[model samples]
Target: MTPHVPALPAMGVVALLRALLKRPRRPLPSALPEIVTEYRLDRLPLDDIARYRAAFGFPGEHIPLTWWYLPAQRAHLAT
Candidate 1:
C-alpha cells in the first residue's frame, strides 16, 4: 500500500499577520525614474498644424488641454 501524506493546516489571520510582520521589507532604490520629459513640438509626430488639430478630435481654432504632452513615451525612456 502507498503511504498517505497529511494535509497542512491553514494559517489563521493572527498567524498570517505575525508572519508578515516578521518578514523583512526591501529598501527602495535611491535614484528616481525621470518622468518629466520636456514638452517640445519637435518630439511629436504631427507634421503640420492641421495634423495636430486632427489628433486632438479637431478642436476648432484652439489647442485642447490634452495636447500639451509627449505623443509617445519613447523619448522619456531614452533619457
Candidate 2:
C-alpha cells in the first residue's frame, strides 16, 4: 500500500506565494481573436468561443482551476 504524505510546510507555502507574487503581471495574450475583436462577433460561432473559454477557468467561472497548480504542488510534495 502507498503511504500518505503530509501537507505542505509553512515555508513551502510562503515560498510558493513569494514566487507567484514575484511574477510580473502582463496583459492576457491577444491571439484569441474572438475574445478581443473590436467589432461584433456575429461571424464567430459561440460554440467555438465557448470551447476556447472552457479550456481555461475565468475569475467568475465555476469550472475547476486547481489543475494549474497541481504540477508545482506535486513536485514540491514529492520532495
Question: CA lDDT of 79 in candidate 1?
Answer: 69
lDDT of 2 by residue, 1-79 (tens): 9899998756678788998789657878868655432323245344544554566644443433454354456555755
Would you estimate the TM-scores of all the predictions? 0.33, 0.20
What is the RMSD, in Å, between candidate 1 and the native fold over all Cα?
A: 11.1
| Residues 1-79, model 1: lDDT tens digits | 9899998999999999998889558878899887675645554344555577886667676655555544446565666
Native-referenced Cα lDDT, model 1: 0.66
Q: Pick the candidate with the highest lDDT.
A: 1
Regions more than 4 Å wrong, model 2: 1-42, 59-79
Q: List per-prediction Cα lDDT, in the order shown.
A: 0.66, 0.55
Q: Which ten residues in a row have the lowest lDDT in candidate 2?
A: 35-44
Residue 26 error for model 1, in Å? 5.6
